[model samples]
Target: MSKLTMPYQCLKQCGNLLIAARGSTIETFNLESRSLVSSWKCPSSKPLVSETSAQEEVTAVESPAPAEAAPEESVIPPVKRRKLSLSETPAEENKNWKHNNKGKNHRQAAASTGLDSPAVIALAVTSNGHHVIAVTSEDKSIRVFENSYINLKHELKQLSQRTMPKRPCGLAITDDSSTIISADKFGDVFSLPLVFQETPIPSKNETPVPATTEADSVLFTPAANHLTVHSVRNRKALENQKRQAKPKPDSSGPEFEHKLLLGHVSMLTDVALHTYNGRHYIFTADRDEHIRISRGIPQAHIIEQFCLGHTDFVSRLCIPSTRPEILISGGGDDELLVWDWENGNLLSRADLKGHVEVVCHEHGKAATDGSVDGLKIAVNQIEWIMVGGEDLVVVGYEAVPALFVFQLTAANTLQHIQRIQLAGNVLSFIVNSEGVVVSVDTVHALFSSSEQRNMAEAVDVQPLSTFVFEDQRLVPGPAFEGAEQRHEVPAEELGRLGALLYGLENLRKREGDGRDED
Candidate 1:
């Protein structure tokens, strides 16, 4: 599915709780109790109404006071001021002004573009799950929240918010929680400080002026307002011009709060930081089927090597918690690739047909092996879970209405383990050691379409489901291959032999029937 069709959504797990982003709100659920702990509404971009109100406030504060009226006796008696009859009052004038500007059109456009209600598109949590960070589409801001895991509380406290110049699609927090790195729609990866610090003072004549707000930076001055109505159309036009006027990259250009670490020609979907053998590396996946591994921190731009085996847009990426050197990734392609990114070796790959049945490309259309296309089903999200002494990868899909689990076997292979059927397309999910929490399209989709529905009856709002697996299977006793079991075939092998014998019998029966006809 295209990004526009899919809402900005993500899932992150911490201890016994899961934090999920659904539209404009972030919700937390307790995996143990299978209950919702809390939900926090994310803030959207500042409203267009705020622009007019802010201008009015500025006028009230900055306008010059009217000259004191001359004393009646000192000034010649002006003609008795007759109250001038008017067709409209100030309120009516303002109402007509808004109507003439077609404010409704602007509001509708904002809604259609998802500007009015931006959602969280990316989220990350620390190992302890005590800290959370997310990127919102509307404001293009990164917000950090403190999770009360120790206190076992319902609410999360927001620590800080930093706005970005471009809308970010993915973000990664260092395991130490010291820095946050994000990939934006502009094909750029940037790093921002997680903790606030004081800005250093510039020497005399070196202090750079701060950037102005969006409205003030582009809108006309009072003297120039008469030239135009200053409606949303003009505002948009000015904004577009401002964006197009951005300077090309140069060494002496103004710096940003986020330092550019690297860039790509295609849109980046996911970013991750991995540490192996005391060395840190940054892994980035893009829409053009490219996954780059680079040296972390100060040498982030230094090229290491690209994991080059994907045939479609690489969307979801995860490093197994138990195996730090291994990387698992899947996108629109039918298969997921396992790689030793640290050593640049493609370890193994597995087809997803066992889990999801969907055409990878449109009928009669030749599939492009390494190009971005709209015809394929993509693995939307992935997370690692350890259960039953097995390292499992929980996979969620964009077009499929179910979740699949694959175990990373000790033999270094990806094996299908289980599938969890759901009511609607899986949007996002979080898998902790304890259980899993999933978010779907809607609660109504979970039930039969023919169910008699009451318009006002409250649906159970059951978008969140927690499934816990606490029973760790025990190890089996030793078995001798040459003993009594030597003569017996395993159930799996027996089934294969039975299928072969059945096919031979069918062949012999067909031959006998043909001889009789002859």
Candidate 2:
């Protein structure tokens, strides 16, 4: 993609790709012309309406006047034409929707060009690996990438139209890559159409269809089976009564519905697909700090059980290839939690305190900002838990472009770990069933282990390890409250949970070694 670059101008607004990098300050190349796109600053995932309403921006551009001015009255006042958006607002009433107009908004050019932000935090190729659906951490907007995941060389297309609940944290395209499901910070779950879109036939080729006066809606042509929702919860964890669990010999196998899976009090982070006794299920990652495995209908997406041990946010989850019921999760506290879908008990929690301790030992004391005791780090930090095709557990940290591998099994055990650090920060990485990990940095990408290690050990390796390790004061156990499984969790319970973490904080000593344990 780089060698083919030509020179091109920067884009007006690119909120979608910005969140794809987890709200980090990233510079994307105009690969065609090889020119650099502008830097993007993704605002937090607040309602877009909130920002628009609060801002009083300059509205229009002043047209240039002829140098030979004859009469002062001959000057034509600039047209007060409002910017038009096709999808939003009625055609007769064109209210502004997209921000920072590309042409003629001289008055508010500065604000529009302030930054180009990524609207999606996580993007996933569907189970069948056809479409790409992404969630923006900045605004919870869900953009369904228009290209199939079959070829990376294909031009990726995204629209700023589809949206999720709010503060979307995670996204998933279904097995067929047709349906998009995502989780928000509040443990709310949402679904959107992942359409296989195409441009209408050229006007010259075909007769136009009759146009309706009503605004054209973004519809899911092969719409979701909102009825016959036999089971909404995809977690195949429970043994259904023989009478009720009997697999219907229907052509489609399972039914579909627009059912609410559930909710968490804290922000939900991730969700995974599972199957039990030939039934599908879903497991959710939540701030309530629980790995909840649940199965039920949309109206009752119950939390069957929870794997709780992490003291902070559950950041990432990796489902295994060999064993469908097994999965691993990484926590904000640097701990990894392994869970068994069938059995809800905590499978294992890795002693990740050592990973950091060794780094601190090698680097002497961590670089402190000097202002706060927390080890100053990047604000939009992301960690990954990946499983290789042959059952290897891979831990990735964005701050340090590092990869750690462990032998993993169906029983949810990790052993014989190998560490291969890469140069620069691990901005993003992807692994498949075959034990291969492709890591991305500011510049180059490395797929082979030897090459990645060599890059990490390079003498001129640029470090992106600025992080602030503030004490994640143990909040109360209401942690999993943010996991989006069931929606009606009580807020009062969450408050009590917060109280628990606060008390634990006072009880646990902040060891000088930087490991605060409760």
Candidate 3:
């Protein structure tokens, strides 16, 4: 039997350290030495139970056992049973009803735990490099970890964990590192504090009961009665309503301090926070092919402008630090879009499908899998980096084993430079002063066909690849010395990796006339 290796899903670089997430673990490596530094695994989904609480439960059960073992002093006399009225029920009956309701609630809570194990889907580092934020899939939680790189710690110290109501697809930290902005698939964006503080519980004496007014003290009666409801069906509904217990107000939202910034009618795919002219702005892209710009923080409700040109879902957004006014967006479209976001103008579109077709042909696969008309390109990432003293743009596509490079022209257009082919699909990458470190899926886990996946498994492939610029083109760089260590992945967990790593394809709309698109 062969051991299965886990593929990296996310990568982030902080100074001389590199953080990578694969499976449910986060590993940090020292880039200078090219050695693994530390690893931290996410906690389980089961709620934690304290030792004291468990002891108390055991004591309660044992205390009842003693009473059951007690000997009877004398023969107990049989008490006369009292007949109950037709309108009243026995106490045992009510107890059974409450027990049944409790069981139903317990089952519902268990069902929502989901089948997949917790896997880190997204990662972000604070600008100060003092903290790291990770988002997990199973619990939909945002976790904060203290970065203690100077001390050479063995594991990251988790400071806090706050679960969100919906799964967060994108995460960004403010420049000041005081707040975290998260965009979810439910079409809502929320901001949370970097360090969460638990709300203190107040004593019963601290809470004052409200005084009853004259109207509150009076008995309430409804105007609708049997006479008002003429039909038999209406009267039956009225009786059922009266017998049913009133529903309680929902309190399932997050209890921590969080504020809603802005929302869209379609699912949000990415979010970016930028500061231009001393004012913070938020740029968001959605599956409905809409790019929205809004004022940050208190003024987030104000809509600045919309950059709309693509006819397909927009999955990635990039705002170059060198060119803040230029926004690059890509998704299900065959071309990459260049936009002057502030003015809501589409500067130019670069052809990406042609390059993808060439790569697919070389790999012995058709660009179109017979499901779509033309070759569909899902851009996974768009990053700006300086290579050979020239500003360049690097783009990676989902399930494509290649990285496309282009130069941003003075006229605000993309000029093709070079293409760096790899052995497997590009999962994620981080660019630094040294070179580019890419996390590749050598196992072909993202591929849909079984034949392609089997062929990839037959050959041994490296999970991490490196590249450097030479003569304005990408060339192979020195291998990361100690960063090639692979972690073993169990067979059972392989089924869930598809949901964690391959999600952009789910945004594709089916052939129908329906308004809703999943």
Taken over the whole model, the C-alpha lDDT of each candidate is 0.62, 0.43, 0.78
Q: Which consecutive 10 residues in model 3 have the weakest lDDT in total?
A: 107-116
lDDT of 2 by residue, 1-518 (tens): 11111101111112222112322222332322323333333344323554254333323233444577768767566546454333234734433433433343222221121122433345566554334455443343565544422444334545333444355556655555566666765676665556634344447867776454333332223222335234646222122221132232345411223235677765576777666666666678765567877673343376677777767666667776556666677756656667775776668766554564444444443445322134322111222233323355656553444555566754567763665554443554333322222223422233221122232343233322111111211111111111111112232212211111111112222333221111
- Residue 443 in candidate 2, Cα distance off native in Å: 11
lDDT order of candidates, top first: 3, 1, 2
lDDT of 2: 0.43
Q: Model 3, range 1-518, lDDT digits (tens) per residue? A: 44556778899986677889987889988777777788888867655666577556666654444345445775443433334321134667745655666523232122131322588989999999889999987678999998764564545779888889888889999999999999988789999999887656578779855456664455434457887899999888778766644343567877899999999999899999999988999999998899999999989999999999989999999887888889999999999999999999999999998888777777666645523335577999988887666778899998888899889988989998888888778889987645688988745543341213453362466677888666777778766555455576544335435555666876787654233221
Model 2 residue 459 distance off true place after TM-score fit, in angstroms? 11
Q: What is the TM-score of each candidate against the true structure?
A: 0.61, 0.50, 0.75
lDDT of 3: 0.78
Per-candidate clashes, comma-separated: 0, 55, 0
Worst 10 residues of 2 by lDDT: 1-10
Model 3 steric clash pairs: none
Q: Given candidate 3, what's the lDDT at residue 346? A: 99
